[model samples]
Target chain A: MKSALSTLLQQTADLRQAIRHKSHTGVTSGLVQGAMQGNVVILPADWANEFLLFCQKNPVSCPLIGVSEVGRYDMPELGHDIDMRHDIPEYYVYRDGVKVESRSDIEDIWQDDMVAFVLGCSFSFENALSQAGLTPRNVEEAVNVSMFETNIETVPAGRFFGNTVVTMRPYTPKDAIRAIQITTRFPKAHGAPLHFGSPQDIGISDLSKPDYGDAVTINDKEVPVFWACGVTPQVAIRNAKPPICITHAPGKMLVTDILDTALAVL
Target chain B: MKSALSTLLQQTADLRQAIRHKSHTGVTSGLVQGAMQGNVVILPADWANEFLLFCQKNPVSCPLIGVSEVGRYDMPELGHDIDMRHDIPEYYVYRDGVKVESRSDIEDIWQDDMVAFVLGCSFSFENALSQAGLTPRNVEEAVNVSMFETNIETVPAGRFFGNTVVTMRPYTPKDAIRAIQITTRFPKAHGAPLHFGSPQDIGISDLSKPDYGDAVTINDKEVPVFWACGVTPQVAIRNAKPPICITHAPGKMLVTDILDTALAVL
Candidate 1:
């Protein structure tokens, strides 16, 4: 009989292959359950070092799970035969600062000077939360996790600086407390929530219309709990106005073979 | 030179001695800083088993730290040369579920058929919070922590049954998240909070008027964070209406030699 982990790894590998072939170009949330998914950032080598410092300075917002060698597309440490250029289901192209277009593959624009960075995503903890029966509202509603720009400032590094971006999940106080504890275990995946209750306190004027991704239902008796999000780097990158950059489209991630449980600390 | 742990232990011993001699008949909060403080409950042997079951059923609210042998006032596991009859600054006496009077010492009322229980108190985590620079509002305002009777029910065990009581501390959303992480390490100290935000959701009608203890200032941006409290068991004891029962007065806890940090789990 095949071991559960091996079966999971095989499933994840198959999913990645499907994504790479453009046969599965859609939001990757909830796909390949138990596997780790990463937020992609492809930048020129000239800009990579400063971006690395930004990640280190604001680890809660951009927890770097894997970084490819300059000009390399494969992150061996993150997965087997993972091609950064095509593994993500969808890619968002940014020129100067603004997002230009979304594509299934970035192979045409892939550069020899590009450095690929894979960041740990909150989707890892979502699996743990669902197993614990504290399914997030986004998962329950089958929509993109709500992402918003907050007034909270991120530590600046070189040209990388902007207000942090956050993902909001509405949970009742009881379940929110449990969610906090569960997510705290996955520090590399943004750790515990940054805030809960009163979105306006974080300068999120509206929860119904997020800066990125679809807003889910915030039921009565539930307070919006906010986690530092990986998309924060994209905002910083826009502020920096790098000549060119590539990132995974919101809700579409680069799936890896690493087990989500492997990210838990203590 | 004495090690820090030994020095703390010695200081705790001296503090206990002071309380035993009636030289210090006041709340034990912030006294002997790193040592543990416990909620005291003395009941006849007949009712001890039921209370034990009650603690087990609701471990978050009544985390059992030490229990004395029937007919004994000494709890060696809790402290060296401990005398439960007098170590607490003040004790509340009850008969038929009614609080009759308060006493400096229980020596005159100590019965040969009595059993002493020392349940963990939330003060154990206050030191941690303060060290993290997130001093609880009660500590800053120099008042007892605001506590309320919540509608949340605890599992009933025999005669002991009642709603859970919770202690509240107001903090900005950021600090509350950190507080949640810090307190979660000490399961014996009520672990993580039961709720944060609207008090009415948990049956707390007014933040200004707590059912027990003084209400501290809830700053404009701060939300009240609630933790399961040791006082919960006292409420249960009242509902049970045991023939005779005794407990430490609110804020007047039994100082033990155990370090507060020692109770933290990974």
Candidate 2:
């Protein structure tokens, strides 16, 4: 049974490889469905300890899944022979937390002192929601999910803290409640919502002008439900002003062999 | 350990008895604090089946914890020997789901074919919320919790179907989200909130004119938080229009011996 499950999961890895080969490079949203995907954060060893503590303090924002040995390119626990450099369709390099460049791989920039932290992503629960008959609108529209920054404070760690960044999904109050319940089962994926209803309540001035990703239509009867974004710790990293940091560009996630059901608490 | 827990629970029984004796007959707020108290519903066996199905369909509203066998009044699991006739400080006798009269006890009205259902009450979570340092304003002010009937529909079960009734507590949208997280852990006590923010969205035109219970303050910065109510099934019972039914008067509930921990999912 384990081998059978593993065989099915390898197919997911094969699909991710296809996406990596530019055969399926476009957002990787619906491909390899039902597998848990992760947001990648790689940083120098000097800032790695502080960033680990930051994720511990602000778990809702950065749920850490696997941490690689210093300078190690292999994230064996995340997937079989997962290469951090080329697996992601895109990458972001930040200097002092400001985006400096984008690349398809970082083999040349790879350093022995760098540590890769695999944080859980909302795409995990997005799959669960869709399976439960509440398909997320962003998935239906074939767009990157909207992202926003909220005033809600994250627990501060040494030189690593910022307000939580949240991803927005429009849901009717009824659907929003169900979404809250469904997302809660996957705590590693920014469990539950940080806020719902008015944008003003969370220091958000407008729904249309999102800080990152495209804003989808929020129907009149629906409210924009907010979940702590996987990118939140990235914001914290930016504020921390690390010498060098790398991340999977938004919407380009690290597909893992883990099944979404493996994370359910209930 | 069982005996020790039971010994601790005896204190609650003592307080409940004191309330019945008029030695402790206020709102029962903060009385016997940690013990699980329940909303009481009593009905003739003929109407009991439908009401049972209603509670089954509307678990958030009428979470049936212990059901007394027809023609019996004992609930050993809830208490050592809880006498339904005079145990509660208050009681409301409903004829056809419309409350007709109330009394301290109904030994005279107690029927041979009557069955009793005791549901986990919101007070269980009030204790939890208070401990978490988010005690509601109504509890702080020593007033009845405000309740409203909503346009949200309940799953229909035979003749027992009506829009859900919800209790209102005011909190900023951010805090309301926390409350939803906290209360979602207690499914026996209504689970997460049904709606928040707009009263009109759920077909409630006025927040001030609550259909049941007293209205409380809703500050400007705060959004009105709503949860499924213990009284929701009572409203459905009214719609069902049974020949006879009895329930604990509003704010009055059956004191049970069960520890609140018994109901917690996590």
- Top candidate on lDDT is 1
TM-score for predicted model 1 compared with the true structure: 0.98
lDDT of 1 by residue, B196-223 (tens): 9988889999999998888889889988
lDDT of residue B74 for candidate 1: 96
Give the alpha-carbon lDDT of every model.
0.92, 0.83
Output the chain A TM-score of model 2. 0.94
lDDT of 1 at A242: 94
Residue A232 error, candidate 2, Å: 2.3
Cα shift from native, residue A177, model 2 (Å): 2.0
Q: TM-scores, in order shown?
A: 0.98, 0.91
DockQ of 2: 0.59
Instruction: Judge candidate 1 at residue B80 and give its lDDT.
Output: 95
Candidate 1 i-RMS (Å)? Answer: 0.8
